[model samples]
Target: MEMPSLYGRVLPSPPAVDFNSAEGKRLFSEALQGGTMEGFFSLISYFQTQSEPAFCGLASLSVVLNALAIDPGSRWKGPWRWFDESMLDCCEPLDKVKAQGITFGKVACLAHCSGANVQSFRANRATIHDFRRHLIRCASSQDCHLIASYHREPFKQTGTGHFSPIGGYHAGQDMALILDVARFKYPPHWVPLSLLWEAMNTTDESTGLHRGFMLISRHTAAPSLLYTVSCGNESWKSIAKYCVEDLPNLLKAESPDDVPTLLSHLIESLPANAGALIKWVVEVRRKEEGRPTLSKEEKERLFLKENVLQQVRDTKLFYEVHGQQYAKSCCSCSSSSEEDSLTRIAAAVCCQGVAMLSGNLASRDGLCCRETCIRCIQANGDGLKTVISGTVVSEGNEQAVDMLLPISSPYTSSCNSTVSDEIVNYPSNTDVLTVLLLSLHPNTWLGIKDEKLKAEFQALVSTDNLPDVLKQEIVHLRRQLVYLCKAEEAGSHVPPSH
Candidate 1:
């Protein structure tokens, strides 16, 4: 059987290259001498396709040779079996070589270049590492470029022999660049491109995943970008893309201005009706500023003013209802004496006699005698004195007069005797005198004269006389005694009848 000449149609030759550059010649010589025949062909093939190859020629050579070494019996195996049988063909391409190359290019660009024998390349660690490093360099040089690796096998059943490859690379130095190249659209197991880049740049392993899978990027220098993908329960696909770009921005914004702008952007990105919640929050904050704020002294002043105003209004209303006439009279009286006007006003309003004295009264405004009106006029001090005198006089009977004065005459001739009698008898009828005597105690009678004392004793006895019935009994007994004395005198010689 003769195979068709698929050389130009399937696997075309590489474009012409200037072997002028020392680096280029050195690479070419190394590939030929190292028994890496596929690597040399890959270099030539890369130049033939496009002016600037999308993938590194060296990386492509390493990938293909490594894949072939894993599966030696494959038809696509190259001439690299001379160095080590361990490096013989292992990766068997499912389609033709040209188709495989096209697939590999697309997969690499999408960051999914692990479809065929990627796991088998583990035996060739040097080749795999070199390939990964070359991809990183290529992607790093171009801001738009990204690369990724993946495991092509379906999810393994429990206890099955299937496994994942390219899981060791973190965000910063290795697999992170692939994530960055793919723009973080690779497998869910890969860390975010931004985080992988950050991790690579920062060299921070702690920033990325410990197990499962991770992505990293070099977006910032301070804190490395890092994100994890877990296959345990939840899917990482939904949040993976967002986390790469949004998380870094969220963590970096520190000022109020930045926060509001960020928050607005976040709100806008949410589903409809979510913006209403944020609007409500902002309104509440604005309302808080309008409520009254009070100071200690100002509050106290307001309270005092209210009390004074209430008092003044009450006083005015009272005067308007009861003291209108007196108020008019007070004007005339005030000219003669302000005390007199206040006294008249108090008496008119309270219906009591009042006196105003200089020592006992003063005005609220320091103009008129307000205290005199309150004490003397409203209290009727003069009328109280008169009532007291009248009470004493009305209580005076014949026995009362005798008890009060102890004078030989029926009537007390001296007014001094009346006063003395009143002073002495005061305690027997009044609580005030009793309290006064208690207060004076042993010195109570010190200033009292003998005549005054006699009058006081008489008054006390008179005030505390026996009842009329007892007095009548005494009178009858005295009469009976008189009759007996007369009968005894008349019957001096005769024995009194038994």
Candidate 2:
């Protein structure tokens, strides 16, 4: 039986030469002969078709990461640690990437976050000579791969921007093999190196930066064992403002007697919405405290595994004890009246103060009735119960939470006024304090006079536990935080325009 030819899918010339074409075949052969097909041979086995229309960048990255044998350090599925499009979401949220394709800088950022040594070059920053030199080197090395972020319109492809790995280089013909991740639209092809460079030389209107390329290879050092920052520069700036600006003001205005209130205020003031809050909290494993089944040694081992800031653990432990005392003192109150019960529960310190900050004291101006407000309280309480009871698991990944909190008003029972469970379990003091410590050095809080508060906030700032690359990134963010805070202090601050 003869197979049907799918040559019609091959894009016409002036754009790219399809790999099955005679010219492309000859280019591949020559590339192999010239020993420049090392990357092609290494990457071919791991090449993937993008799962989403806007996932070209992630697909390209997964190919390169797997080719270099870089472990993702987390399970991609049951018992498998591998690179996938879903795991490449350390820089931008996957939903955002799904709506609008990733940018060149973000691609490099994701690569760096995923344990790769990444060197990114914007079209404006590097000469064509430099690109060609890097391209040739990448093509010749099995360990290194180059991903081009370019405008597809220049190649006559039906898209604005696209990302694909450069598999091989035909030095004689000056053509490069593009292992296009969008296999549904196009096949692997060869394009003139200069034409590819021209495509990359265009501007990405979204970033106001020229599109370019990234050289990615495996990092030789051990990856970060515990913490990694995931949010963008803008969010980091917001954290810095809250830490260095809003926090100091709050501290100065309040007394040590108002510590619980102060902690609640800090949690409520955080810039991260529900989704971001979830991401931050899940990084730290939840400790199963007061489990009689586990011995003290077992409990200590479990605490060590909850690889979060030591101060955060201590603060949580303190809150647990504090909350228990508050609950016991109020145990004698009557629960006959529903309204009184709701009010009493609302006022109680719950979810390590996250429930109080997010549900009870959280603004409810838009809510339609008392039931909706009560539901919010209940959902938050339930979510916290789920978190502390160690029942929060999605599929096999304990860190994931794909559930949404149903928040329908009574008047419109079918309305889609739902919130992510992430938001329901929003930033507690532990989470906000972590951000504060990350944004401003702990020494900045030395002005506090409360012995207990001082002990909680006095945890030494140490970057030694972080990977060198991530430490460098944190240092950069700290510097940016300082500059932003200084600009605001000078009264010359201008809000950024979206």
Candidate 3:
């Protein structure tokens, strides 16, 4: 059968010079002579086509991320750890991204979430001269990359908005090399810097936000071992409102004894977009209320989604319980100043340079990563054991064993070794949450009186008969927990605060 066209070609009418054309090669040679093609080799090494029509941003990000040797901290397909469009779901859901594409801010948010240093400039917020300077800096440096979100119409291209990494610059021609992710439609091309800025200056109709450019670089510290919660979604405001305004009011109006019932009501009354916070609660409730037996096929179908929910719940519980432990533990070093204390913690945990701190060492007021280095430590008797189980591969009988692993076995551990690690050093917040959950004691979940929450806790901590990858993740977390114990033991002279 004859195949239909996938996308239209980039018309020669566009002002941009195709990178493979004679004129393009001439300009690129000139760019190299002017020392503006320093970053070109790095990007070209990992250049990839966007897998989906609307996944240009993801593709560009993946290229830059890999070029910079940034670890995605998660497997891409099987055993290899790398960045892929599918792994970039922290800022926006993949389904939403596939349908609506992504915005400049969201792209920057994803870069930041992936443990890269991001500096974003919307067209309205920055002048043309500023963009030119950034372009030169990015093109002249292999350490950084520039991604532009611009309107295709300005370049007379076939699409609306687009994202592509700026691979090189030509000072003499005043041109920028766009390593367009949508290679099917447009090849790598050199467009006049002024013209590219004009494209980026246009407005995106959906977000009512200006198109822009961003500079992404690797973070100075090592990637974080644990995941943290992010408040970047549309439901963040409602979640915050519920936590700050609604929760306080609910507590004050109800008696202490009635609070539990009120909370249960609150769970039921929560808005549908309570987002990631409530799905696990609802799942847990359904599991307990129904306790329905399922066929092997059903369990296999639900495994991926359920595992994600469990990981999220685990991270939330960890931050709630031990977010402040690192600060407290560092203070135990008896350093004379906050800087000195941070220095000690860095030496102990990072083992390289200073471990990056989130805020003032005295307070846990912000969302810094307080749980790092737990993986390097060995799991003492108190921490969860590293249990290697069945492979995550989907088949007949093994799927049943992986699904039936006991989730809520009772666990007891001494609180003596429960010291916290570094803050906010992780790449994706999801990873942060996953690692944090691993460090948790079974008793932490068992202490909660709410049956739904308890069920959610069980899901988070359960390691029995899981897929190999997930079990490996648990082992990593347990390793981190072991470090916590070691840190606590070193400072055992100062008793841990309850």
User: RMSD for each model, in Å, please?
Assistant: 53.6, 13.6, 18.1
Decoy 3 TM-score against native:
0.54
Residues forming the 10-long window of minimal summed lDDT in candidate 1: 278-287
Q: Which stretches in model 3 have alpha-carbon errors above 4 Å?
A: 1-10, 223-227, 230-498
Q: List the residue pairs that clash in candidate 2.
A: 274-423
In model 2, what is the error at residue 55, expressed in angstroms?
Answer: 1.7
Q: Which candidate gets the maximum lDDT versus the true structure?
A: 2
Rank by lDDT (best first): 2, 3, 1
**Residue range 1-498, candidate 1, lDDT tens digits:** 997552221111111112334533453454334433222232222222111122222233233333223221112223222112112111222132223222222222111111111111111122334445543433333211222222221211111111111212232312221111111122213333333322222211221211112111221111100101111111222232233344334434422233234223332333222111110000000112232232343333333333322222233222222222221111112223212332343222221111011111222123321222121010122111101111011112110000010111111122333343221111011111111111111222232234454244233322124333222222222222222222112211111111
Relative to the true structure, candidate 2 reaches a TM of: 0.54
lDDT of 2 by residue, 1-498 (tens): 997754325485866898988988988988999989988877999989999989999999999999999966556655466888987765677899999988776677677667676667777778889988988898898989999989887788777899999999998988888899999888899999889999999988987778888888885653432233434324554554566677777666656644455455444555543122112212222233343143343334333323233333344333432342221111212243211243333222122122112222222222111111222222222321112221222222222111112221111122224523322222233333343354455455665667677665444344444544435534444443443344212211112111
lDDT (Cα, tens digit) per residue for candidate 3, span 122-142: 787788999999889989989
TM-score, each model?
0.15, 0.54, 0.54
- Better candidate number, 1 or 3, judged by TM-score: 3
Indicate the residue-level lDDT of 110 in model 3: 74
Better of 1 and 3 by lDDT: 3
What TM-score does candidate 1 reach?
0.15
Clashes of 1: 40
Weakest lDDT window of 10 consecutive positions for candidate 3: 278-287
